[model samples]
Target: MADEIKPAAQQQVQIPVDVSNRETVYANFVQAHLNADEVYLELGQFSQVVTPTGPDPIVLSHRVIMNFVTAKRLADLLRRAVSQHEQMFGVVEVDPNRRLRVQQPPV
Candidate 1:
C-alpha cells in the first residue's frame, strides 16, 4: 500500500514597525549636535536627489556627513557620495582640492 500523505497548513502574521519622518530625524540630530567642537569633522557627503520635472530634472537630495573614522574619512565620503548619485540635475562632481585624492580614482 502507498504511504499516506497530507498537505501542510498555512498561517498569516502581522508585524508592526516604527516609521520615523526623515525631516524630523534630521532636525533632532541637528539639535543634538548643535554648537559643539567635540564633534570632529570626519567625513561628509553632498548629494542632489532629483525627480522628473517636465523636460528637465529637479534637485532632490543634498546631504552631508560629518562623522566617521579619521585620516581617510574625507576621501572615503567623497568617493562614496558621488557613487550613489543620480543624473537628475547635471554632472555632479566634487572639487576636493586635495593633493592625494586628486591622483586616486573617483572610487
Candidate 2:
C-alpha cells in the first residue's frame, strides 16, 4: 500500500477551543493532516475575555488573533503539549473573586 492512501477509518481530528470569560478554560484539538514535512496548526482566535475580581487584580491574559494557519499534525502536537503541561502542573483555574483578571482588546 502506498503512503499516499490512508485508511478510510483514519479520521482527521480537529481541535477547537472556545475561550470565554466563564473563568474556566477547556481545550481540544483536531488533526486534519499528517505527513513528514513541517507540521501545521489552526488556533482559534478570541476577541476578549475579561473576568474582574474583587478589590485587587493580578492575573491577566492577552490573546493575539493569529490569522495564520497550521497543518493538522502541528495542531495535534500543540494540543498534546498543552495537555502534558496541564497534567504536570494543574488545570488553570479562574478565580471569580481573585485578585486578577483576563483582558483583551475587542476583536
User: Best-fitting candidate, measured by TM-score?
Assistant: 2
Off by over 4 Å in 2: 1-70, 93-107
Please list all clashing residue pairs in model 1, or write none if there are none: 44-65, 45-65, 49-60, 49-61
The TM-score between candidate 1 and the true structure equals 0.20
User: What range of 10 consecutive residues in model 2 has the weakest lDDT sum?
Assistant: 58-67
Q: After superposition, how far is residue 48 of candidate 2 from its true place, in Å?
A: 12
lDDT of 1 by residue, 10-101 (tens): 76878877678544312111111312323332222224344475333322233343443442566687667766664444445445455235
* True-structure RMSD, every candidate: 16.1, 16.9
Model 2, 1-107: lDDT tens digits are 65696567967899988767446433232223334654433323343345574333323242222223444455588789988998998665546455255555689
lDDT against the true structure, each candidate: 0.43, 0.49
Q: Considering every candidate listed, which one attains the maximal lDDT?
A: 2
